[model samples]
Target: MKTGNKIKLFLVDDDAVFLKALQIQFMENDDFEVETFSTGELCIQNLNKKPDIVVLDYHLDGIVKNAINGMQTLDKIKETNAGIPVIMLSSQDKIEVAVSCMHHKAFDYVVKSETAFVRLQKVISNIFKYQKMEKELNWYMDRM
Candidate 1:
């Protein structure tokens, strides 16, 4: 990918070890510019940076169940920038949770596992393709 096409990715998870691992993985890959946060609040605070994609954990510390969770974070993110795509991360394998994330407009959801990195790569590629098409469409509309 060209330098101008490199995607900015933000990862938010409460697990410090997981965050560090993901940071290292992305750093080794040239396609992504990765930033990580240990809390959803920190990620929200950095919205001005306009990251192209956000990877969010399903459960967060200090957030009440059935009230505020990753789904709530997803909503807040969309409120801030509706066009920004988000990928929900969860250890849960329940289909309901995955469906809920999709219903709430998550770009994709992946279960935490050894293959998580592979899934993330696929999601990033799809998001990039969608974003590129969106940008082109908007440009064409502007020329009309």
Candidate 2:
């Protein structure tokens, strides 16, 4: 996925307005190529596009009653490509929810708020930094 210069980002949320706003936020920056999906199923279907990161809504079934939720989506994504990073987004500020997301292998959990985008930016930055370090370490180990 890192083969491209710009990060490919998948934004999955049932809230049209919120999804559009978030898409606009990421699109304003040239660093990302953003793709928005209204449901987890749609996002999963398009996962073959190989997005570098996925920002998934915790309540993905808001529009479709039987649609898969964020946790399920995360698990499916991991099953398909464990290397892809998934950040779970939700209005739930509960510690348990965040912990559950972490347990389910979410790269991070973010609460939807005025400052959510700012926090997301920081989290994304950290993710890339960590990936870089990991890559470098692997390179060094390979030579040893």
Task: Highest TM-score: give the candidate number.
Answer: 2
What's the TM-score of each model vs. the native?
0.86, 0.95
lDDT of 2: 0.93
Model 2, 33-99: lDDT tens digits are: 9999999899999999999999999989889999999999999999999999999999999999999
TM-score of 2: 0.95
Q: Least lDDT summed over 10 consecutive residues: which range in candidate 1?
A: 60-69
Error of 2 at 115 (Å): 0.5
What value does the lDDT take at residue 6 in candidate 1? 69
- Tens digits of lDDT, candidate 1, 31-92: 78899976677788899999989999998764334435677789999999988899999999
The residue-level lDDT of candidate 1 at 72 comes to 79
Q: Which regions of candidate 1 are displaced past 4 Å?
A: 1-5, 62-68, 135-144
Per-residue lDDT of 84 in model 2:
93
